[model samples]
Target chain A: MFDTQSANFDVQGLSVALIQAELGRREGGIPIGSALISPLDPDVGTEEVPASGRIYIHGHGRNQRLQKSSAILHAEMDALEKAGRLAPEVYKKATMFTTLRFASYVHKCMCTGAILLYGIPRVVIGENTNFKGEEDLLRSRGVEVVVLDNQRCKELMREFIRYHPEEWDEDVGGSKETSARAS
Target chain B: MFDTQSANFDVQGLSVALIQAELGRREGGIPIGSALISPLDPDVGTEEVPASGRIYIHGHGRNQRLQKSSAILHAEMDALEKAGRLAPEVYKKATMFTTLRFASYVHKCMCTGAILLYGIPRVVIGENTNFKGEEDLLRSRGVEVVVLDNQRCKELMREFIRYHPEEWDEDVGGSKETSARAS
Candidate 1:
C-alpha cells in the first residue's frame, strides 16, 4: 500500500523534489503546496528540544494543504516551532516529512526552512540509518524521526532545482521559502 | 483536531467496550464493526515482514482511506494480514489501528484481531510506559503496538475478555482466532 518498489527493503521517500514535481502547483501564480506530519513526532511536540537532539531531513507543507498520510510529520513541525528550537513564524502554516538525507533542492529548502524557522543550526537523522524507530526512539530522548526507505527516497535534487526557479537566487529573493510561495 | 482531551497532553483511546457502548449493535446476533487503519506505517510493508526484525502495533489501512488530519495509525491490520503473518481471511473483512490502548472496544478488537490472526504469541508494550515510539520500535520487530497513555491504559484485560467472549474460554472454542467470526 505504501507504493514501494520492494516492500521488503523499500519505502517511498517523500522528497521535496517529488513534492515540487508532484504537488508544487501554480494556479495563476498562486502556488498550492501540501504537507504531512505525524502528531506523535517529537519535533512537532510543544516541548523543549533536548540540547543534543538528532536530525532527519524534513520536507514541509502548510497544514491547510497537509495530506492525511502526513499528520505525524505536520505535528513534528508544530513541535519544532513550539519549542524554541525552531523559529515560530515560518512553520506556522507548514507540513513536513523527516528523512535521513537532503535529497533535493526542495528537500534542502524545506530542511533549510526548518533551520531558519526553528532557528536550529541543523537537522540530523539519529545514529542508526535503518533503525525505523529512530523517530520514536529519538522523540523519547526528544529526538523525532520519520523513517524513509529507498523506494520512497529516490534522489530527486535535480528535479527540485529544475522545477523551482523563483527561489533559486538570493539576490532576486530566490530564497527557497520565497520562491516556494506563490502570489 | 486529534480529538485529544487537551491539546497540551492527551489523545482519546478507542476501545471495544467503548465501541460497544458507542458504535456496536446486535443486528440478528451479528455485530457490525467498522475500522479505519492508516496507510503509511512502516510495519505492514505490503510485502513481507522482515524476519528477525522488529514489531510495532501496526494499525494500517488502505491509503485510499487516509485523510489530512490523521496519520498512518489506522492501517496496522492490513499490513499484518498482507505479510501472511495474519491469515488472509482474518483481515480481508477487517481493519485496524495503532494506539497503545483502545478508548473503544471496536478499536481493541481490530487490533487484538491483528495480533491473534498474525500468529504473534503476545502483545508486549516496551518496558518504557511513556515511550511513544514503542509501536514503531516494536513493529520493526514484527510486533505492532498502540502506545497507551495512563488515562487510556486502564488495564482492560477484563473488558477485553468480556467483549471477546468467544476467544476467552480456552475450553469452549475460546481461541482468539476461533471466536472472531460473526454469523
Candidate 2:
C-alpha cells in the first residue's frame, strides 16, 4: 500500500521525486516503490546546506508527505555511489524513502550526495556547520559527535574492531567493516 | 498504511514480524515504519543455508505482510551490531528493516538478523542457495552470480581499484581498498 512513484520531478528541493529525477539522469536506472517522498524543507540547500552537506536524522513519519519511511540519515552515500564506491541498486534503495537520505543533502555531487549514520559507531563527524542546526538536535539526544576525517574515521573503526573483531571475518559478512575500517 | 506486529514468533519461517520480535529481545529496540520485512521462503535457512549466510535480493513488495517496503538485502551488519561495532541508534535503525544481518543468523549470536543496502558501489555476490529457488529468477535478470570468499573478493576489488583508482581517493570513501591495497 505504500509503493508510490512520482511523475512530478518539478517539485522544489529534495524528495524521492527529485532524487528519482536525479537518479534517472545520473545512473540511467529507474526508482522503484510507491510513495510521494518529498523534502520536508521545500527550500533545503538554499542558504542552509553548507558546502559539504548535512548529516541529520529525523522521524520521516514526523513529517507530512512521507509515511513509508521512518528515517533518512543523509551523508555522502550518493557521492560514494558516483565515485563508484557502491552499487546503483543500493543507492536506488536509499531513495525509496525520504527521512533516511536527508543525509545525502551535503556534498559536492548534485545528482547524488552523502548519507550519515545515526547511532552508528565509527561516526566520521566534523564541523556541525555542514549539518545546519541538527548538531544541536543530535547533542540533545546525548550523541557524541567528533572529528571524522579519513584518518579519524579509520581510528574510530580501529577502536570499534578492538571491541568487535569478528566484524573483520569474511564469512560473517565483515567485509562491510573490512572495507570501511580505513585499512 | 501497512504495519503488523506479531507476538507469534513461533511461525515456521522468517518474516519481518518474527525479526521484529527478535530485535526487541536482542537490542531492546522496536522497529518503525509500515511493512512485513520477511524472507520469501517461510522455511529458510533450514537445509538451504550453507555454513555461511546467503545474500539474495528480491522485490520486497511481493509479500502481503509487507506493503510499505519493496526490498530487503540480508548481509553482515547484524554481526557488527552484536559485536558492538556500531552505535545503538544505527543498530536500532537497522531493526527498522531486514537483510545485512542475515549473516548474524549463521554465526555465534542470533537474536534477529539481516539488512538492506541503500545504494552503494561494489556488490559482493555469491550463490543463492540460501534463497531456496530464486537462483533461477535472479539468473533471468541477466546478473551473474559468482563465488566470493575473502581472498576472491579481495583480488576482485584490487583489480577494480587498479582500473578505477579514482575510487581509492581518501575523500571518496574507498577505505576498503585503501587498507587492502597496502596488505
Candidate 3:
C-alpha cells in the first residue's frame, strides 16, 4: 500500500497538479502537468494553500509546425524553467509533483538531465508504468522517487490517449522514422 | 578497426565539428560541438565543402547565472533547434556529427528524447565512452550510431577536462546535491 502520510509526500502539490492536468486537457493541449513546492511553503489550514511557494506549469507536446518532429517543450521542463526563473533558491529545495511518473515523463521527453541539473531532490508522481529502469536510473543519481497512483491521474492519461492516439503511441514507443522518409 | 571509408561516413562533417569544438573551447564555452548534414548536400571536391546543407552549433554547459544549476542549452540541442528552425524539411533527413559520442552526449544532457523527436536517421561521433547502454538504446530506436576515434577529438576532451575539471566531474557523475545544500 502507498503511504500518503509520508513526511516527504506532498498531497496538496499532487492536487494542484491534477487541476493543471485537467485544465491542459480542456485547452486542447497535452494533459501532462507539473508542480514544484518548496519546503518553505506556509502551512495553511485548508487544502487551498496560497501560491507563495508552489508553482504549477503545463505544456503541449511536439510542435506540429516544426514538421511535426520538434518536441519544443514539455510540462515538467516548463515547471523547472519557470521555477528556476522565478525563485531559483526556493526551487532547489522543492519537491516536484506531476500527473505522470517522473521516469515516464523524462523518458518521453528526455528532461532527466535538466532535472538532475536543477538539483531537484524529490519527485512525487501520480502514475506508474514500465519505466522502472528509468526510475532506477534517477534513484541511482540520488533523486528520491515516489509514485501515488492517483485515480484521477490515471483517468487523465486515459483521456489524453483517447484524444491524441497517434501522439500517445509515438510518445510510448519513441518515434521511429525510416531513411526513406528523409527524402 | 574503424572504417573511415564507409559510404555513410562524413569525414568532412567531422572535420567541421572539430573546428566548432576548438572555437567553442577558445570562446570559454564547453568544447562540445555538433554538425547536422543533410543527405542532399552538394558534393564538393575539397574538404572545404560549402555550408549550404551543413549546420554547426555549440554551447556552454550549465548556466552559472541561474544559481549554477540550469543547463540552459547544449550543443546537440542547439544544432537541432537551429536546423529545425532553418530547414525543418531538410533536417528530418539529416545525419548528426559531434565531437563527443552521441550516447555520452545525450547521457550528460538528456537530449536523447529530443534526438528521437527530431527523427534524425543517423549519428556520427568522434569519441566513445562507457555510455554503451545509451548507444544501444538509441540503436533500438532505429538511429544509426557510428564512432570515429579521432585523435583531435580526444585531445579536445582532455583539454576541456584540464580547463574545467569541476564541470567535467559534475557532467559525468551527474550533479548530486545534498538536502542541506538545498536549504
Candidate with the larger lDDT of 2 and 3: 3
lDDT of 2 by residue, A86-145 (tens): 221222223223222112222111112122121211112322222342213223433332
User: Which residue segments of model 2 deviate by more than 4 Å?
Assistant: A1-114, A117-183, B1-150, B168-183
With candidate 3 superimposed using the best TM-score fit, by how many Å does residue A104's alpha carbon deviate from the native?
Answer: 2.3
CA lDDT scores, all candidates in order: 0.28, 0.24, 0.54
For candidate 3 chain A, the 10 contiguous residues with the lowest summed lDDT are: A174-183
* Weakest lDDT window of 10 consecutive positions for candidate 3 chain B: B57-66
TM-score of 3: 0.58
Model 3: residues with Cα > 4 Å off, grouped in runs: A1-8, A16-27, A36-72, A82-94, A102-109, A112-121, A129-144, A169-183, B1-9, B15-23, B36-72, B83-94, B102-109, B113-121, B129-143, B173-183
lDDT of 3 by residue, A1-183 (tens): 112345534676777777777777776666677776664432232344344433433222221221334333455655654443433333455677777763334433456655655566788887765244343556676888888868887777676666665555444332323111211
Give the local distance difference test score of model 3. 0.54
Query: Each candidate's TM vs. the true structure?
Result: 0.21, 0.22, 0.58
Docking class of 1: incorrect
Query: What docking grade applies to model 2?
Result: incorrect
Q: Tens digit of lDDT per residue, candidate 1, span A16-37?
A: 3234323323221112222232
**Worst window of 10 by summed lDDT in candidate 2 chain A:** A64-73
lDDT of 1 at B42: 40
Better of 2 and 3 by TM-score: 3
